[model samples]
Target: MLNVRLSIGISKILLSAYCVLGAAYTYAQSQRVVVTGFTGTSSRVPQEVDAAGSEPVNALPSWEAKAWKGETIHNQVLLQGGTQQQQVSVTAGDLADGKGNRIPQQDLSIGWVKYVWTDEFRDGCGYRKSVDFDSSLVADRIQTGTNTMLIAAGKAQPVWVSVRVNANAVPGDYTGSIIVDNGKKITLPVKVTVLDRVLPPPSQWHYALDLWQHPAAIARVHQLPVWSEAHYKVMRPYYEMLARAGQKTITASITDEPWGHQTYDNYPSLIKWTKKKNGKWSFDYSLFDKYIAFVMDCGINQRINCYSMVPWKIAFRYHDEKLQRDTVFTGAIGTPAYNEFWSVMLRDFTRHLKKKNWFDRTAIAMDERPMEAMQSVIALLKTIDPAWKISLAGAWHPQIEKDITDYCIASEARFPDSVLIRRKAEGKNSTWYTCCSEKFPNGFTFSPPDEHVWMGWYTAATGMDGYLRWAFNSWTARPDEDSRFVTWPAGDTYQVYPGPNTSIRFEKMIEGIQDYEKIETLRKTYKATGDQVALNKLEAALNNIRISNFNQQSATEQLAPYRSLLND
Candidate 1:
């Protein structure tokens, strides 16, 4: 959250963010449109539109009105660490002056000011997506993307307003305004009264959702080569979104092709391996550097998971420059020559990461290798760098738990309660992952958003520190229209679309993470004050939650009633 506003050229970033919305369309040639904001639910806009359209409508939604009078709307909010949002429906009508004179064919500029402290106007306001959730909290959340859009003369669109108060924001009343230019001026007031409390930074967050990213998918979506700047630009938003969701590790590919079906096909290698004239092995790591830097720049700086040390099947080719031919290298785990090659490669890679000051946070990742193969791979890796962190995404290998830095076990592994509890107590960073096997609580579009939100709560309930899903943006071939691939459910291939715009499932998952944080925060706060009664109440709130019950209420709705406990 703290790293979000590091300006990489605000205008350039805005252009990139608004690329989907084409250049500003001319509004002068169209009939002037009236815009008004009103309280609304997903089902209906609460107020009737003014047909007379004589008065300029409020451009900003009210943050303090007691009731909606159709002409003005007001709602108040309490500051929280996570993001909080409210939507106001904006309707447009034929423009007219208060004197009932119709004004037509004019262009208007649109803009909004950072919510100032009305009292201390210099203090800026940021936006948040969840209530007191560390991950989505932003120090500067009030800025809108592509500030201008043309409103047709008799149409309506919803202007979603969101606010976030950072963990350390000073307590006071803050005010801001959203201005809609229609040749005539209309301003809507926004107000916030920050309470005297601070949220812990993300380092204290307990829920970890490992959203694995597919850079190749990004390249395909943008029609660019892997590691190209164009690819990085399109991929930045996705990684940043994950970072905002409290993702702790960055997933990277060294050379293994993505979705290779356990064999090489359309997937291209990022690591280039070459066979020298003297029969020596050489690798080019230019691609890895570009990708790692790209992800780090987007705020995924804590850990790097370079997947994978052991690929599904070890088969790679090296080109012979002198002979002008390619030689495919193939071997099973523990083949003397293959082991030697990987030992050298990993040694070089470890040295590279150390040079970049990334060795400590780096892990050599593997996916679903057999226990025997995993042991062999670990042995080979340790020969190169004894301190190298080994990460595996598969069933738990009890014998190798001590060797693993992060073990993402599948749900079907059915790890016993004792083992799970022991792992947590031992300070081992482990988690659970779901793929084709997970059904009820999943990220599919058909599934309720609550399931996504339930993930964080479930993880906490089960004594796990995080959750993991294989595909971040592993889009289907027809990603725009469908999310399903041949091997998995329709939405299983990806939880988000190409724009890096989120899906309902993703939104709900965030809600769950926020809820998890709130529960943990409440427990910590009560414990610190030695209030056993309040602590028991907080525990009851968590104990009462169930994955099956999530569908009954949206996460926000269910969590709202506990605000008194949280506020106190």
Candidate 2:
């Protein structure tokens, strides 16, 4: 039997009652009957009704999906068939399942899109990705829904991301492609030049360098767009050696005292005071002075992290020993004892110089103590002079880790954009995380946001970071000694593999030169005017350029001697 119910409106019945009654009798009597009816969402509008009328009695699932606006009209009808080779037709408001019953078509359109995809990645792997864009310059009425509507195919496809635009847009032609995969990308080109308004520049880019990066990172940096690759031959020696020693230093060791003594506690004045007072620490700059001289002579930017305020003997216990009473940090660097000591120490460190009147230029900043100790140091330094750039370094864990990250981000906005973490693959009976940097045979863990923790290069490329720390130099070239380096005086020998010397000087040099130039440019352009926005943009651009695979930090060292000219 065929039952069709058609109501045109609240008061009108449009379905042919006579035709349906006769069809029901025929359907009940037929043998090979073909029953067909339309099934889809109905809209209460004259135009949508017309479109529904245009649809065929039977259509494919793919062609039957579309949306129309008007009013609510859930159409329903049914065609029952009992005959073979016999056919019955109906409109979209009708449906039937052999038993002459109407069925809902709601289950047909499954998993439809609700928003358009905006391309954001560049063509390749590491380095190039996010393109600089002003979120306020969108030109079109953006739409988001379960349908994907694109006017073009292949390369002509739109690649631009969208942000709701406002009236004050300084418009002009804006265009670019986001890399999707190798040789595949979507592009959106727009021309919206406004009258009498200046559009932001497409981008401002710069190179970056960190004087203490793995040489592999340095050699790789040379491939970025910002690196002056043509002039990178000067860093050739620095990088080539590292590249040749491509193997990683899988073992990492940290001694209680990397320098074998308190930073400035060995000077004549410090020694005299300590000797007379029976102190555990003294103030001295003999080694510091020599280190500064060596860097100046090497003509390389000096980046270093000072380990501790208290002597290793007094601060961290040796092999889990108790803190000795006689220590450098007997609350002597602070008040009642002397306030000038800490401030004077930094002041003198910054001001100490050779005949050229140039003190050692340092960028590495960190204090490894708890937040309270760090805060005291910061406060004292700020009072004595607020110009010194100080960064706190400590275990990136628990509450203290968050404190460190928060302070760095808010105080200096210096989060590293890229982090390289060496994670060991999981295997049966293997219970350890293996990275190329260090070996913790006894099992060591790093608190995150520590420069050494891996976060990939994405965060760095987008101005969320300013430094990356993965420092390990293969000391196996010292051959007979433990390749797992512990630096000097004492050594930690937990090692996995043996290899040639792994010096990352090349990478460090590259980072240093690039960053120096970048900061210098910012100072030149915005220092006098105090353009924070411009400065932020400059920093962002530099960060992006730093992550680009094409960056040329390998050529960094050779140009350092001439950077002063560029600064001028």
Candidate 3:
């Protein structure tokens, strides 16, 4: 059944430019809806809109008012390696019918018609993480939409606008507009001012962070049976998001169940291991090849961390040819049979990586395990090939630190600061990671934006090469009920929700990464000019950046005095 409605009323043309006190502007279209330039913090747009009454809204602060035609739209700053976002709220119009009553929310038409891409800042961060933007690939017009919503008259519906100016983007004003399809032709101006600086490419990100990717969790969240083309469609945006965030490592699983949880689990295995009727081990890499290629295709071309040649529980099941049945093996790492199985697997895997030109970029990665397990696995890996790269994310293991290609230190562990600084100097990767340990500097929902933004600064300050947080899309079993699972903190499980919609924490972390780049930029300037004062100011700032806590610090306030200096 098709439903339609018709309206015939006195033609009214009303225009009012209302400016809010301070840095906000609102325009009304015949009292039907009003829009004010807004900004998104760590919270989602809906939450921001719903809480608009009690909380003060934020907008892009204009350095020069004359540059803006309307208060809501104009030049916004996007540092070369950073992300900038703006929001506008569409509210019920302030018009009255003949009966002196306001119009209903259902009458509002906030459908965005098209986006005008002008100049070099042509890329748009796709709506709600639905698609990724690559600047090399330009588009004439971008059509955007939000969920179907009916905002009541006088109530505001916030719309999100995000733009990522590429590191190589020409530094200038890129003009554009959001054209609304309402009866009134309203155009909102968009001018992105790209700065002159460069974000490191994925391969040289300097941070060897590995935020684990779980295909199974995505499948469960979207309620799809098995990984199909539909699963790929649901999954691409997430990998793309991480890639854009300057993520360097690719988390790949080898076989099913990953050596733990001998019961039902959802973690997808890339390899289908089998023993044929001829009594020889055989393997399939179809899915493994596809997923890695997919992630690389999403623009994450960097080190590949194939996880857990050894896991905690130390067990797995495989088909046996002689018995013509499935067999279970439960034992420690480097046992004869265990060594035999992994020998073939790792050798073949290395060959596969070589075929794909990922051999030097690949690492045999392992999770948290005891020192004995680490030693055994390291030994077994050496037996496979002395030159095979290895990655381990766990407690401090000094005996093996020099041998490991990448050692991801846990936040709780203490190693002499000089160890990592020296390692980084030697072109070795020294990084840090945090899981469900020490509550400080973690990315929980309740954790302040300062916590998220401080991580990158701390990494750079401590002279660590990179940082890692455990999960990308590892959603809770009952993500809908609450993202918190079992005993973990409310947001410790994941930084992003199902829609690939970012959390405030994720956004703040990106802010911190940009801050780190700014610091690097300043250091270079200081070296070239022999500016001791600039070096002194950087030292003073670092004094406030304690690893244990933010101490309620404001990242913006800390960076304010140095912004122009670094840019200069």
Candidate 4:
């Protein structure tokens, strides 16, 4: 990854990362009584606790853990089936931590007492919500909505009680007072939104290449000293074509090994056994930079620059496999050094962008946030630019959900729509993100989001993500079994009039998607529609694309376990 280390402010970054990641809470108070910041999954408690209490002492207010939410003690697992429970805790900012005060006489929140709860530590290390808060809610996977249950608004979506309540037990709406417990409580009712008409597929999320600039022009760029001409001939042209096809977003990973299909795991290796540079430990991205310039020339919109890799180097050196895997992101590994390094890279990358004048044009993403990494990233971004569009991988240590987001939004105070509503003078209001994504080498892990996040497979709304994405071997004029559009069947065919030799199902998949446009359209316009039938059609259409794409990808995956196989 060629990341710099041990410099000015590195320590500060690390320290902050540690604190922000809940390290402070865990280290100081192992057994914490908490109500806010509970995600159904993908996040964890910095401190560990007991899942069961002694004799099931009662606790009041609503209780929530990752995917499941309830209001009582045994109810966390299930007490009285019909009895209700509420796990009450103070709201953030409403009051300060009652640190150093005498144990005040307790008041039952609608007659509830404090009980013990554990770290829900996914049975081993890191938080994945391996167990359920209640066995009853296991089947409702979609409700997690990307393994998270709620959405929090930053800036001004304040929490106000819609229905009121009396101290005594009664079942009716009772509007009384605002619970100002800032850190303690932050929940609200959601205004469900539905669309009236069908809209066109968004095609800006991806950047494609121009089919016109292939062969000659691209062939020349590959011959330069820093690049492998043949590899350039294979991949570069297609990358360009993908954008030229109106796919506006592109991702350029540095690779030194074989990856999958025509696609090489071509990631820039920061450690040993990398493919390029004759096995240099510290990678040189200079040549890659040139290729990026090529992409820039084509007017690509978004780009994700990642030197981020699992720190196999550190994990092996320290002899901590868990740390090693965490280095690669088994879960959250928030630490000061991680934070320091993360902020360092982000800061440096931000600087590089400014120098190249590509800073404002693209939305930069910091891949896979390690606890340590995010600690520094959050703080650094706050310092450098609070408004910087940032993102985190869905695989961090968390039982995290809407509560945690609620906490983050409240603390960060920025709304999702705010990014959508920024004024011209303010800057771009585009906030793009993905959650619970399939791991590159492995298939998908972690639970899906609360709802079926409409795999919006177009260029714009989804960037380069689409159900009918087409990938042929290469874009060279050379005729080969693998290539998408080749020369010969001859010059004019490959040049002036590009065409597909055989109708590879790739086109059929696109047609399938085109056919599905109606289903998607209907999904938007009507309120009460047929769910099962529409799902079946959507599934059939989507699967046509998935199965087709996978057949191609599975083939790609097999060839080069590392990278070069695709390029060569």
Candidate 5:
């Protein structure tokens, strides 16, 4: 009887312990990290509850996206050739056991989405103002650096998953998985379908994407001396990124603060000017040659645009050897001082460029100057060398249209059919540019992400050769943290971040450029095959891509049917 009682007691104790252990295991299993996928176009705020006072929802179990061979597809599963990105949100459910003990967070080994503070403005255009606007933290920056993400209980973290599809990738379906280890391994499957069509490599692209560069900003952001070896090293990745986007023109400054110190960083002259004791001017082209070679080597060999026969301030800087001091020449346009000042430089520059075999590809570039000033500058350039090229990005002036070799007018401006035809026939390049002036169809951070992509299609539809913007990396004081400036809307001064990080704006813009390339390629192919039906279909689709359509329809909606037509 005693042995029986002891056996029953032991069995009861064992059963009770078993039940407790099982319950603990079940509770632990319930506290899993939930992973959800979202479209790249949708900017999700980093909050546990949304503005609707409810938790955000996604039906996807794992992240999946599709794209073409050379396009960069965003989180929306839109297709592209270059890369496919999926925005994922990882949320930690009750991170503790039933005992209410704190559970350690897991280290997420993937790319993170950085939230930047942005404001809601009346229009996407114009300079910065003190007007009251709704402000919030926006997810824009995609940091690819290896950083561990830890999520607290009931909180979520945004992850950026990008997969690059090579230019020569075979058109088919591809599959991968993102494994998140939070004590237990949770595998998220990723699916990508590469469309049959191919996007040409950036080098083969004809789009003249001229995003004016600011090397000085790179140096400042990296805390290195301007033009230092380390600075160049840091700048290499940035320029290479531009090259990958099919950049055509090399922005070279010939005078200090060429835009009259409009940007945060001063635009220093690449060619050093010095007035000798004998009163003759000479230029040191070492920096100019190095920079041009550097950019050309990076595959931007189309045109070396030396800035300003007409700077905004009209103040030229040169070292006065006799006084052993730096001097500034305030010579107004058309003045003898101005004419003589540029005449010597132009003559010497022409000789130097010819010797380097770069004269044919170099342009005396100007930006947003008066028509009279442009006429005088063009006359001076022509007087020096009839073969000298002149590039201008400003209001359209028909009088100087013939003289401008690479003319980029404002986005609101249009060249007459005759002018476009004549310019094309004469082998001249015509493009369009957008600044803080244009509200819709601009690249401001507050602007819709699709608007950037829309600009590319608009270029093709409007029969423009390429696109131009005033600033590429003219970074603000804290570019990675804040994109706001006193002169322009947030993110107006820079397209990218300091870590050489790319933003949603930059990536989408590149996608549009790729679209432009694909369109050009398909147009030529259709022409070669004499497929008027397909050509007409493509043309009709482009015709519908007007700014009016853009306002009424989302870029995805506007581009979908047309993109499918191209794919077919």
Candidate 6:
């Protein structure tokens, strides 16, 4: 009996030792590096290892995305020209082995996602608490130039991978892998299934994207003098980026501080106005010509939207050659002074634009002005040159609807079917714009990333020509660092960053625009083939996409079915 008892005790001790060894082995394995993939439309905020709870390994699942040829798709990975984006999250455990030896950081193929201070405006719009509210650092800009990232122990890092499927890529399943080298190779597999249909390139797409540009913002952010050679050199990549997204309008301010200094960087006039000593007005088109030519060279040659015959403050500035100083003309719309002020400049400007062959493409643009004021401006523009094209981003007024060539109404308003049809027939463009006034489906930093892409689909469903946004790069003081503003919600001022870096919001918006192009292409092909069945089905899917549905469903959820149908 004593021998049997001693044997039982030895067996129990051995069993307990084995269990302890097994747990240690398992924990050591878990302590190693981990990589997971997520969709580009979804943004993953980095969480501290401690705050991520006891299990951070299972935070996300694998990544997969579908796209059409020539479509730009966003995941953590991106594909353009048949592009898709895929985002990969890398989490490090203790960064040491069970033996306590340190492990090397990984090499990311694309770049790391940078965190920027962002405020959660939730569903509110226009002027809210900037502090003492729900605010945190959100991962946004993808560090384009860097190819490696160092993740601290117990923290995670996100990497953005963009893959461009050639425009002529065959329709089939394609597989690729993102390799993370951390001494030992960690492979993250990427799978993409390209649909049979083709999406036209941005230049050919019918969707007219008009994201207003603020060149001064770019100059300020880069610490370069406005319009300097260095400024132009730096501005090239930025404009080229805009061109890639199918931007249709060139935003030019004819008057100083066009919008009453609403942006962080005041918009200096592109065209210099000079009043001569002999009481005659002369215009200098040197800067205007150079900027417009530069933008056209960058591939955004569609339309030039010159800001305001009526500026927000009803004030105009000119170089008084007589006084050898700058002068401001404060004249209300339709007044004698206002009429005289614009008439001389318009006549000379018209002649100069005609000389450059830019008159036909140029529009005297206005934003959110009253109907009465717009009518007065339109009348004045016609008086200067009946052939003048006009553009307005404001409430739709039927009284002056026929006069504006590029009419972008507020998202809250819609153009009547008859009016839209007439404008389409007249070769005029009608679109919609969203700003701080809107809460849901905006490009605010706190807003869901999917909303940016949703705007493209909404434009397609509503039968609008395209979409317009006020500020493409109206960047705040430190846009790359923080996205908050005193006047509006976070990210309201800009979309892209200083490194000329692209944001998840911006990339996802491009994805949505590509979707829009795909929809348009499919519609045209089906109609030409007399495929009424396909047309009806497509229309049905689009009809279900309503702004009202935003609350009940996510943009991804709404897009999934239509994407599946397209893939089929």
Which candidate leads in lDDT?
6
Question: What is the lDDT, from 0 to 100, of the residue 139 in candidate 1?
Answer: 13
Least well predicted 10-residue stretch by lDDT in candidate 5: 77-86
Ranking by lDDT: 6, 5, 3, 1, 4, 2
For residue 14, give model 5's deviation from the true position in Å.
Answer: 9.9
Estimate, for each residue in 459-562, the C-alpha lDDT of model 4 and write its tens digit. Answer: 12221222211122223333221111111111111211122121111222222232234334443433256556654543444433222343355423322232
What is candidate 3's CA lDDT for residue 402?
A: 80
lDDT of each: 0.58, 0.27, 0.58, 0.28, 0.76, 0.77
Tens-digit per-residue lDDT, 426-538, candidate 6: 99999999888787778887777878778888888888999888999998888888898877878888888987998888888887788787778778889999999999999
Estimate the TM-score for candidate 6.
Answer: 0.87
Candidate 2 local lDDT, 443-561, one digit each (tens): 11111111111111223333332322223222122322222122211111111111212111222222232333335544466867887776675555444432122233222222323
In terms of TM-score, the best-performing candidate is: 6
How does model 4 fare in lDDT? 0.28
TM-score of each: 0.67, 0.30, 0.70, 0.32, 0.86, 0.87
Candidate 1 regions exceeding 4 Å error are 1-161, 168-195, 201-206, 258-267, 320-323, 412-427, 546-568
Error in Å for residue 94 of model 3:
27
Q: Point out the higher-scoring one by TM-score: 3 or 5.
A: 5
What number of clashing residue pairs does each candidate have, in the order they appear? Answer: 14, 52, 6, 114, 11, 17
* TM-score of structure candidate 2: 0.30
Candidate 3 local lDDT, 395-437, one digit each (tens): 8989989878888888767557788767767667888887666
For candidate 5, the per-residue lDDT at 232 reads 77
